[model samples]
Structures are given as structure tokens and as C-alpha cells.
Target: MHGPDVSWYLALSGLMFTIGAIGVLVRRSPLIILLSVEIMLNGANLALIAFARHFGHADGQVFAIAVMAVAASEVVVGLGLIVAMGRRNIELDVDKLRTLRG
Candidate 1:
């Protein structure tokens, strides 16, 4: 028997990416933005794995792994910046952060 088509996976990925993009654009909190970025990364990962499986190649999965590594680093850096701002007693709001000169 045949399995589900690749388009379904791609559609789901698109939906996820759209939601994440909206969250990133519409939210004001730094933590929320970071979470949105993570969501977008996961969507990309899902697409990559889906395509890899469809093509019967390991490259997509390998790239997904690399993407995951980069995503993790992104989270670490994003959280670090947020923590730094917190330590400095700066507001966590993105609009307020734009005034930061340093």
C-alpha cells in the first residue's frame, strides 16, 4: 500500500512557518519572539525531513541536523541577550529595546 503524499507534509510545514512568522512579527516580548523563531526552525526541519524521506536520500536529514545545531545556538544567544538585558534592568519589550544604543 502507498503512504501519504509529500504535499501533505509540505502543507503542514507551510502552515507552521506562517504561524511562526506571524508570531514573530506581531509579538512584542523578546521571549515570545525567540519562541516564534524556534517554531519557524522546527517547521523548516519538518519540511527538510519530509523531502529527504520522499527522495530516499540522507542529505535532507543531515541538513536538518545542522539546522537544529544552528537553532540551538540561536536560542542560547537569544536567551543570553534577554538575560543580559534583565541583569541590566532593561525592559524586555522589543519596542523599548530599539532605543538601546549599545
Candidate 2:
């Protein structure tokens, strides 16, 4: 059985990245921005895995794992900030958060 080609995977990855970029640029909520950043990371991971598969190399997979780790850390920190903002009764709008002074 044959699966979809590398081009298809690349196309999907590009589409996901584009959507994520648009969301990050247009969305005002911190939660939405975080989600969009996650989407972008996933999209890059997809491309890395696809290329790794195409080249029959383990490097891409290794990089994907590293990327996942970074993404997890980013989510942790971002969510922590959001929670702190919430605790302080601050608005969740990114545009209004020009200064994160406590």
C-alpha cells in the first residue's frame, strides 16, 4: 500500500503554517495566539518529518522531537503568563498588553 506523496504533505504543512500565521496576526486573544503558535510549530514539524521520510534520514525526526520539546515549554510559559494576567484581572487582549508591568 502506498501513502500520499511528499508533495502532498508539504502542501498540507504550508497550508497549516499559513493559517497559523494569519491567526497569530489577526487574533487579539492571548489564548488564540498561543493556539496559533502551536499550529505553526506543528506545521513545521510536519514538514520536517515529511522531508526526513523522503530522504530516509533520522535527523529530521530528531529535530522534530526537539521542536516538540520547545513547543511544550512555550505553551507552559505562555499559559502561565495568561493565568497570571487573569489572576490580576487584566484584559486578555494582546494589543492592550503593550507593557507587562505588574
Question: Which is the leading candidate under lDDT?
Answer: 2
Off by over 4 Å in 2: 100-102
Candidate 2, pairs of clashing residues: none
Q: lDDT tens string, model 2, 1-102?
A: 179989999999999999999999999999999999999999999999999999999899999999999999999999999999999999999889766662
lDDT of residue 55 for candidate 2: 93
Candidate RMSDs in Å, in order, are 1.9, 2.4
Clashing pairs in 1: none
For candidate 1, what is the total of clashing residue pairs? 0
Q: For model 1, how does the per-residue alpha-carbon lDDT over 1-102 read when each residue is reduced to its tens digit?
A: 178778899999999999999999999999999999999999999999999989999999999999999999999999999999999999889987655662
What's the lDDT for residue 55 in model 1?
90
